[model samples]
Target: MRGKATVLLVSFALFVGGVLALQLERGGVRTTLLVLVFAALGAVAVRQTIRKRKK
Candidate 1:
């Protein structure tokens, strides 16, 4: 239950970051950083889900 909630929160954060990145000008470091952060969040969410399911 908590794990699911965490995943949802992370996903929402990633979505918002992605949207903000899209709205920003292209070819900037901020956009790249946001994308990297989103990717990391996604990876963490996936890992948490898999770990919880395995347990």
Candidate 2:
């Protein structure tokens, strides 16, 4: 429980920081980061699916 809570807190903090940074920069940085994040998430999801199928 403690570990889960710590992870949640850290994730929330990072999300808030990202939002703040996006607001500060209305240029390509925001778009680039958003694409990178989505690509990373998609890769993780695909990897998990492949592993589950292997099992």
For each of the candidates, give the backbone clash count: 0, 0
lDDT per residue for candidate 1 within 1-55, as digits (tens), equals: 8967887887787778777777777777767868697778879867987887999
Backbone clash total for model 1 is 0
Give each prediction's root-mean-square deviation over alpha carbons. Answer: 2.3, 4.4
TM agreement with the true structure for every prediction: 0.67, 0.58
Location of the lowest summed lDDT over 10 successive residues in candidate 1? 22-31
lDDT of 2 by residue, 1-55 (tens): 7855765565566566566657766678888776665665566557657867998
Where does candidate 1 stray beyond 4 Å?
none
Which portions of model 2 show Cα errors greater than 4 Å? 1-24
Best by lDDT: 1
* Model 1 CA lDDT for position 25: 72
